[model samples]
Structure formats: C-alpha cells, structure tokens
Target: MEEKEPAPGGLALIEALVNTLDVESGTDALDTEENRTRFGLTPADTPGARELREALRATLLAHAGHHPATGPRPPELGRLLTAAPLTITIAPDGGATLAPSPTAPGAPALTARVAAAITEALLAGVWHRLKCCEAETCHWAYYDRSPASRGRWCSMSVCGARAKMRTYRARTRPA
Candidate 1:
C-alpha cells in the first residue's frame, strides 16, 4: 500500500506560538516585578521556575494563528506530531520573516508539541537555512538551503508539475 502525505501539524504549532502569545510582537514588554502581581509572572509565584515555565505554557501551546487570504491554515502536522515544524523566509536583502500556519479561532485545536517546534524554528531563523516556497499562487512554503540548489517544488509532483504542465500545454495549444 502507498503511504499518505503527512499533515501540517508543525506549521499549526508555529502559528499558535506567534499568534497565541504574541511572542514576536510583545517580546520587549512581557514581564516585570511590578506587573508580577497584576500579570502574576514572578519568581516567587513562579517558584522553582516550574510556575514560570508553566505560566508561559499556555502561550507556548498555541497551534493556530491567522492568514490574510485563507483566514487560517491548519497545522495538520503539529496536530499529529510532538513538535510542529516552522518554515522561515529569508529575503535576498537579509531580512528574516516568519509565516504562521492558518488558525480558525481562539486557540490550538490540537497539541503542545506543535508550539515548541515553531518556537525552535523561529529562533533558528536568526541563523538561516529555512525559506518560503517560490510559487506565487500557492501560499504553502518550505525551508531550503541545498548547495546544488536541489530544492525546487514544495514536494515533487505538486507545485513543480503544476508549472511544467501549464507551460507545456500553453506551448502545444492551438493559436
């Protein structure tokens, strides 16, 4: 029997990390002793680092976010696996970008491993190696830094052939 393609669970974890906690956006202003009482984020309340870690636990478990066009892209992989994979986009000009998996609403409809994986990927983006898919119409992107430029389609038969088939038909079609 043929194996089926895996879900985008990792991607969902990524979106959840960025969107649920607003980790990227609110990094600079999150915690402090003063707000500890109000926000309840302090070493005392968060004793032994367990509470601290747990406090951020909710923020860490998000498995979905938002997409402009589609509204939300489910991180099917994150849902399936322990840690959802995160795909980073590095521009030619040396800019780093993160694309979150689409989310439906409130929070993760699945697991926590997805969020951890996304956080890991975003942190790694600082170095490089990840990238978005080149196809314009298809928003689904991937990470690639192969030496021989062996990277092409997001998979093999999907985006790659879509282009080739379109071009071939256009070339052979009647005027």
Candidate 2:
C-alpha cells in the first residue's frame, strides 16, 4: 500500500472535524463526552457544533466531486460561519497561526480556527486538493497527492476498488 499523504495544515482541521462521524462503522464520536474529548470537541447540549461539522464535511465532499451527495451548504452553516470569525497572527520569524477571534467562545472558537485555516488554504490554491472519499461507506477525508489533483478516494485498494467492483457487478448483472 502506498503511504497516504497527510492533509495540509490548513485542511487538517476540517479533516479532524469530518472524521468524528465514522460512516463505515455508522458510529458517531460526538455522541459521548469521552469520544468528543478524544477529538478535542466539547459536548455541547445543542447540536449546533455537530451541524456545523457536518456542513463542513458536506462542503469538502462537494469539492471532491460529490455534488450530488451534497447539494447545497446548509443555511445554518452559512450563518454560523458568518457569526464566528477567526484571527490569524504572523510571527516576526514569518511563521503563521490560525486562531479564533479573542471574543469567540468555545465550540465556535474551534470552528472559527478551522474556518480560518480553510480560508488560508483556499487563498493559497491548495484547499481544492483536500477531498472526502467518494464511497459513501468510507467517506474518509484525504489529501489528493496526484500530480493532476484527480484523486477521489482515501485509497485505491479499499474504497476505490470497492466502488469499481460495485459498478462492474451492476453493469454485468443479468438483465
């Protein structure tokens, strides 16, 4: 198996948020405090944070050519992002960091930080390479390392092969 490349720093935050819901196992890490904490997510009584994370997942999947699966960005997500702004600081040594605005609170703060990183990556023209697996069961987020930026799955051996097999079977099925 090829060693998969990691997502760029900016998109890593989005990848972290998306993987909390394991599609293959049909499990959600955000359902419990322990699991959420494991992912650096706080368990909020409201579903706002999870919804935002799902919206982010949908956005990235769409970028990966899953437009049919993710039609439009939810309105609530648009509102949430607009409400929470991030602050980026540059060090004298030319390093940079993405953080939530000083006034941003808890979950939104984290989300803001993710938003900031995504924005930075987008401006740098590298955000488009970060994509979610096309296989509905996997839905893993991966960085497209292909020279042409055409990768559509986490691994060709796993999700890619499964998709191909499914398509072949469907096409060859007795009619």
Candidate 3:
C-alpha cells in the first residue's frame, strides 16, 4: 500500500476516527487512554465511539461502492448525524460554520464534530473523495486523490498488489 496524505480540514478528524480500529489485527485505538482523549472520549464513551466508528466506516465503504461484511449493521449514519447538537455561528467575514453545542459532552460532542466535518466536506465537493479501501481485511479510510477519483485500495504496494497476485495465481493454477 502507498502512503496517503491525510484528508483535508475536518474530514481528517473523520478519517482518523474511522481508522482507530485495525480490522485485521482487531486492535482498537479507542481502547487506549491517549486515543480516547484525542476524540474527547472517556472510558464510558468507548462503546458509543466504536458504534460511531463502524457507522462512519460503513459510509466510507459505500463511497467506494463496497458494503461492510461483518458486525451488526450500525444505525444509519444520517440519523446519527441529524441527532448531533450543532449550531451555526456566523463570523465577522459573513461566513457561517457549524459548531457543536456547548452542552454536548464526550461522544455527543464528537458526533457533532463529525456532523460539522461532513457538512464542510459536502460543500467543498470532496466528501465522495474520502473512501475506504475495497480490501475486506483492510478497509482503511483514505482520501481518493487519483485524477479519476476511483482509487480502490489504500495502497497500491500492499492491498492492490495482494489482490493482483491472488488473481494471477487463480488464473495459472489447475482447474
């Protein structure tokens, strides 16, 4: 797999959250205190964060024309995003942006942040460029920077190569 640049703006946050879990290794960064703090999550917030992560992963997978293969289906991302407590704030330059409500704590606050990021990405016309790798074992989130915006795997050197090798072996082996 090739090294990918981070997604721009708030989308980076969404990307980071979605990547917290290494699906193949079953290691979840959210299980660590430092990572939990990065997302404003507490020990009690881990379950909710995991739910949100999976939901985001599903959405990113859809962006790449793929479906999640395991785990109970998460709540619809739209429903979860709509429930976020976000308010619009207008700057002196007449630019308005979404901000999480002050009273939202922990997971809710993180949700609000994600909602705001999605909103920004949509307006920037780059939401669809953020996608999960098509490799089921490594559904890692990545920003699709290809000129055609159809990047399939997170890295051509890794997942892409593995998939090609598999197809080659299948073609050459005895029936």
Candidate 4:
C-alpha cells in the first residue's frame, strides 16, 4: 500500500516476508514461482511459507497496536520460532550472533532464516519497529522510523490520510 525504506539488517527479511501477500488485492507473491524463488521456497514449501507469513503479519500488526479483524487465527509466532534450528557463531571480533543451522533446503531453511532474523532484531532492539499498517485492507509491513516509534500507518498519504478522513467525516456527520 505504501513504499518506504526497507527495515535495517535482518529485519528486512522479516519485513519482506510479511509483505509477500498484498491483502487488499488478495495477490500473494508466494503464489508465483519467481516470488517463491526469491524467498528460497520450492512449490512444496508454499503452504508452510503462507502459514509463516500470516503469523508474521499478525505479530507485525500487534507491534503497531492493532489486531487483525478477520481470517482464521494464525499459529503463535513464538511457537514456530522456537522450532527453528539456530546456532551461535563467534565473529572475528568475538561478537556472537545467532544464525540458522545448516539444514535441508525449502521451508525448514526459510523458517531457520526467519528465526535468526528475529533473534538478530531482538538483540538490536529494533524488532518492534517492524510493523504492519493499521489499515485492515492494506496491512503492508513497514519500518517505523518515527523518533517516538508511534507510527501507525505505512504511509501518511495513503492509509493514514484515509483513516483520518473517515474519523473526520464520522465526527461531522449530521445528527
């Protein structure tokens, strides 16, 4: 629904995954071979990928202080993350980081990558900045760059404006 800078570091991967489905148009990028390839998913991995995507979306919405209004409840993200295999690596500078353990390709690999990304973002204290827009129809994922981290929409010109206008009209409607 809006265009903005990608989230920094591994958060970008999370953001990209959450946005694979354009909710307003019902166009899931994962449905296409090219898009699936972009995320290292095989055709057989699509179902698991979609499940992960929805769970991520729900979590992102919560980050923005919103709840999804429809659709079946997604599996808990924490549960899924806990199942991914991760390993700790010591960098040349002695900095330790969590990384996906080498695994068979496809959904398992993708889940490991996502788990690693979330771990990195959590350590960096920027995990919550990755949010989904408040607009139910356009819950696109975005990085909240606001200094106060109070951003609620993906774009002020789009979802934000629309929401504000709706409020304005409701408040001014004839009694």
* Candidate that scores best on TM-score: 4
| Full-model lDDT for every candidate | 0.37, 0.74, 0.91, 0.89
The TM-score between candidate 2 and the true structure equals 0.80
Compared with the true structure, model 1 gives a TM-score of 0.29
Give the range of the ten consecutive residues with the poorest summed lDDT in model 2.
68-77
Each model's TM-score?
Answer: 0.29, 0.80, 0.94, 0.95
Q: Pairing residues by index, what is the TM-score of model 4?
A: 0.95
Query: Candidate 4 at residue 141, lDDT?
Result: 94
Q: Which ten residues in a row have the lowest lDDT in candidate 1?
A: 59-68
Model 2 lDDT on a 0 to 1 scale: 0.74
Q: Arrange candidates by lDDT, descending.
A: 3, 4, 2, 1
- List per-candidate RMSD values in Å: 17.0, 3.4, 1.5, 1.4
Clashes of each: 19, 0, 4, 0
The better-scoring model by lDDT among 1 and 4 is 4
Give the alpha carbon lDDT tens digit for every residue of 1-175 in model 4.
Answer: 5567899998898899989988889998998999999989999999988888889999999999999886678888888877787888899999997878776488878889999888888888999999999998899999999999999999999999999999999999999
Ranking by TM-score: 4, 3, 2, 1
Model 3, 73-150: lDDT tens digits are 876888888779999999999999898999999999999999999999999999999999999989999999999999
Encode model 2's per-residue lDDT on 73-96: one tens digit a residue.
453446668766677689999998
Model 3 stretches with alpha carbons more than 4 Å out: 1-3, 92-94
Stretches > 4 Å off in candidate 4: 91-94
Better of 1 and 3 by TM-score: 3
